[model samples]
Target: MCKSRILLVEGRRTVGGGQIMSRRICDVLSTNYDIAVFLPDGESPLAELLQDYSLHRYPMLEYHSGKKGVSDVCRFIYNMWRTCRVLRRFIRKEDITVVYVQAPSLLPVVVCAVAGMDVQIFVHLHVVHVDRKVRLLLNVCLQQKCVKKIIGVSDFTLQQLSLKNRRKSVVLYNYIDDCIKKTVSSDTCEKPVISVIADVMRIKGHHVLFEALQSSALNVEVLIIGRIVEVDYYKELIDKKYSFQYTFTGYVNDVERYLEQTDLVIVPSVGFETFSLAMVESWGKGIPTIASDLGGMKELVENFLPQYAEILLFSPGNIEELKVKIETILNHDILYREVSEKVHEVAYNNFSKTSFRKKLLGII
Candidate 1:
């Protein structure tokens, strides 16, 4: 049997929920396939995070400008031409079997702009929030007819795409390794700790969490474990004088450590995401999360996160209402402990590495 040459494409520096999902699947698939990855050209931590696995890597053009009324047609053409040079070279050298790319089309619609080729292409549609422009792009991808498959991280993401893309879509939930799964322990201490784990991007709603904490009547001590993705944004939040009772562990090695000590995982997102990997990770840990009512989260209620989902619902951006509910949750220890004990089994059974690998193999 010939080795399947797999080409994975991503468009970010730091790892988000969807990217992490893709990475984990790729890591497991790497056992048999000859793997390579094309990330956007920049200094991203994703490049380093992927280093542990044996895979070839490339960096494509970071910008994708077209009919959105771009200033330079020549520059766009030049980038596309440059991309063709690299992709063609990779195909020949690697004897590529399948190309797995991410959605909202990275490499700046190069695949769509150029004529279709013979290499089998699979697009991972992680876009849960579809505005007018995004809907347009996926339509273009569907029209191309070169795309072989579309993997939606959740059903919510599948519905956002056109009927054509939907026809080719499949749902493969994100997962964590056994190493991490074994470490998913609930906080057994008397004082429950609430922690938020995510990049400090404006879309992540860390600021909203601060507001939620300030307004809450519960005296819960909070610890945040994530990278300060933007220096300016981090500075802005610190400047807001709401920094009390919050410890920012800006980008650390192990997230499981924070999860080990954390009781309540707060997922306050102001924007949409295909699937929340951190939320799944928390579920894997048997630690309940309080997430926003918006985005794909509504459909992805699982493990500990799902158990707490009922009380965690609040109007998007409504901090005052969030505070009131949070206070109510914290005050009720009997309910908290009841849910906490149940998640331990759910987290391991549903999201362990065995299940993740089995699902991937079943699909492929």
Candidate 2:
């Protein structure tokens, strides 16, 4: 018997957790099904990962709420309509059996394209929609007949849906590579080195982390990984006054190389971060981590590892609280090792590629 055909649609062209998750999904599903991915025409690490698969690229305008003028609105609508037409034609021509929308922004267009077709649609949500209008629109689209499953990277992502729509939603955590080995031990560091593996965006809370470190007396180094997606935000961060030593490594392919040097990893997102693969990656390396007690970060601690919630979480945007947490971990070696060992144990057992593939296959 021939395997069924699945089409994965990714809206954003940027390299982020969502794109990385998409690559993981493709890696898992390709063995069982004939896969084709639709992505924007661009040079990115994500595109490179999917190079081995059947790929189709289009000029995709990413969804944003910052549009002001009438022309901007018109252009957005035109692009949406164009994308819908393209998707509709592709589905019919290729006889696709299932359509997986990787980003929530593409949900509206994907729903329209699959209308009146014998295709099952699955939406994979990565971030919580902060805009009420966008949330309402997504809730409506998710209720369509074609949409079979609403998969959230965390339970926090499904909170935006209507109670009725959420009944159809499932929480599937993102995957971490099992091949990641612990190279640098947490006890080996002399001067502490903290790393933040996220794009230099304001919402990612680079400024918040910097502010927390400003009042600290310890001599530590901070490494800001990933590319600068927001240039203005990068400029603002650079202009700020700080006390600690830091370096901005603009987009490195081998993140594991940098992770080898990191003593502690921080996910200081002040915005609607549904899930963070960086935290999982850090834990897989037996590195202690701290994250803002919001969205998926809070959910992961309270739901899975409730015993260590106090040491692992802090209030979002609370500079004093963050600084104290940093000091608490740095001052005590025993406490740091306990968290590191427990974190690595949990991360390794819970987030395996085998488990992720099983859950995803069961859903589809």
Candidate 3:
């Protein structure tokens, strides 16, 4: 019997959380489906990661961070038309039955709706909050007959959509990749190593972590592993003096190596997190993480990993509280080991690849 064909659409050119999730979804689905990815035309960082799957290049537009102008509007219109045309042709040529969009994009879903290919559209929402315009667009797309379902990375993300949209939405947590699962835990260092695996942005709360480190007398070495998206903010962070020793490894491909050596992981984000892949991945490796008690991070720890409860979560950007949590872990070895072992067991049982694939198959 022939397998159903799927076209995975990702609009972003750079490697980030959304791209990582998209790649994992493709990897899992490719076993049962004839899967191909549609990416923005250029040297995408995802190209190296998705070498096993077939990729279809298109003249996809990059995400604009600046204010919209008349030229921006014109470009948006042109890109939409171009993308729709390309997708329509690919669907017809490949006889694709399903089109799974990685991040919520209005243009691609609209294209699939009107393409007249008898294809089902699945939009996986990775963002916790979207602007009014994008939210409106998503609502309109969700109403389309061709759009089968809306997948959210977390409950927080699903709640952001309208009530009508919620009926058709489902929450699917991101799973730990095989590479991270293969990581062997190392012995705790003489001076404990704490790891943070988010881009250097203000919203990610790098400054808050530095402040916590400065205020505390804990002797821990910090390992920061991510790209420097905000140059000025990063420069500002590095320029200031701190009490704790830290090293920044900008944009490393393999995060498992750093995760393995560290005694603990910290996710101190001031902004809302849809779902933290870093936290889940670290837990899968039997490592305990101290995350900000906000958004999905709070939900994941409090609800999913309730064993750790109050001990693992701290108020977002609260340096004193964060410092206290870190010190608690560092000061007490028994507490640290107990939390680590329990969290790893829970994560492995709940967030394994086998469980994720089974859930995904049910939806597909």
**Steric overlap count per candidate:** 0, 0, 0
- What C-alpha lDDT do the candidate models reach, one value each? 0.67, 0.85, 0.80
lDDT of 2 by residue, 199-304 (tens): 8888889888898899889788999998998999999888977888899999886788898889899999987678888888888888888999988888888876
lDDT of 3 at 77: 78
**TM-score of candidate 3 to 2 decimals:** 0.93
TM-score of each: 0.85, 0.94, 0.93
lDDT leaderboard ranking: 2, 3, 1
| TM-score winner between candidates 2 and 3 | 2
Q: List runs of model 2 lying over 4 Å from the truth.
A: 65-72, 179-187
Ranking by TM-score: 2, 3, 1
Q: Which lDDT tens digits does candidate 3 get at residues 1-364?
A: 8889888888777787888888889978988998988887877688777767888887865555434456656666777788778778878898888889885654443455356668888888887534566567668777777878888888888877778889988988888864244232323457888889999989899888888988988787999899999999999999998888999999988888788687888999998898899998888877888999887898889777776767889888899998998888777877877777777777877787888899988898
lDDT of 3: 0.80
lDDT by residue (tens digit), candidate 1, 293-362: 8766766664235655677566667788777766665666676656555555566666677777786665
Q: Which stretches of candidate 1 lie over 4 Å from their true place?
A: 41-43, 54-79, 107-117, 129-131, 178-191, 302-308
Candidate 3, residue 13: the lDDT equals: 75
